[model samples]
Target: MPIRTTETTVTLDHPFALTSFDSVLPAGVYRLEIDEEEISGLSFSAYRRISARLHTPAIGVLSSIREALPIDTRELEEVLKADRTPIILPAGE
Candidate 1:
């Protein structure tokens, strides 16, 4: 039973919320950690994602307590995609 962990930083320009979090997270860099397990009985090495963790309070925010909140990969992807997509302002302001 071999397990692998990958870490990456994700930046969000706008505040967002995740199901795992109690409140909306401020816009900033967040640490994302993904854990996977190697699939057995395969000629080629393959890994399946087991869990994902998102660091709270962003990377630069000052807080007494920091927590790694569990998150779903799919939901995280959706939030990232939404963050990347520009908001369309129709008509006159």
Candidate 2:
């Protein structure tokens, strides 16, 4: 089961790339368009991604790492900021 699915679409000033635990999204902004769950004492989730050819395209699907990971969680809205910091999930989760 999934707790929820989240999507945050934002315009990038330049080409952007976001790398998550199991997925990577290459530079693209959706001008015309855009775009999880749990277990035991721990939570595990799976997600299916959709992409827009005209606007933003999904680079890959992502799954939360279940073992030896810190589970770095950030808002998509935050990552797409002008700072352009890379998203890194710590191990030992």
Candidate 3:
């Protein structure tokens, strides 16, 4: 018999911290939950792969911010929630 599958995909205009999904998921192996999850035994492999690619750029921006200005996490969070895409840059240039 063939296995039945269901898939969900959410593409954000801006990248979100992995924590964003915490509210929706319980700690378990979830497959077929995301379109990327369909890629074999590693259910979240695709998401991880994509995140790795984005990490470098994101980190560069974060580092730049730390160098240039005093950052407030609460204020940043409020701004981020309002904007679909917020710029994150490393402290220097």
Candidate 4:
């Protein structure tokens, strides 16, 4: 999910460049258009914050480790096959 506030029609050939300020968009359904034609629809959600720190002494070590990791295609397939359920987070919990 992404955060989008305003809905503006842009040409598909030249999509509007996104900026940090555009990141302030609220969560909602969005319709993407190109030359007055509806191209796609997207739902944007609030940004999720993450806080983590990794301490390593070797330079470029983390890069190598990340590259060595294997991508599980089955996980992606399962996500795509799963039913579409609205993700609801507890408010101020």
Per-residue lDDT tens digits of candidate 2, residues 1-93? 434434444455455434433444445443322224433354654443332222234223234522221222343445566437665789975
Worst 10 residues of 2 by lDDT: 65-74
- TM-score order, best first, reads 1, 2, 3, 4
Q: How does each model score on lDDT?
A: 0.93, 0.40, 0.31, 0.27
Q: Is candidate 1 or candidate 3 better by TM-score?
A: 1
| lDDT of candidate 4 over 1-93, digit per residue (tens) | 332233232112111212312222222222321122222353732333221111121222233331111213343234324424456889986
* Stretches > 4 Å off in candidate 4: 1-64, 80-85, 89-93
lDDT of 3 by residue, 1-93 (tens): 123333422233443343323222222211112111224566553322111111122221333322212223344355347455567898896
- Quantify how close model 2 is to the true structure by its C-alpha RMSD in Å: 14.5
Candidate 4 lDDT at 90 equals: 100
TM-score per model over all chains:
0.95, 0.26, 0.20, 0.17
**Can you give the lDDT of residue 2 in candidate 2?**
36
Which candidate would rank higher by TM-score, 3 or 4? 3
lDDT of 2 at 41: 52
Winner by lDDT: 1
Top candidate by TM-score: 1
Mark the 10 consecutive residues where model 1 has the least summed lDDT: 54-63
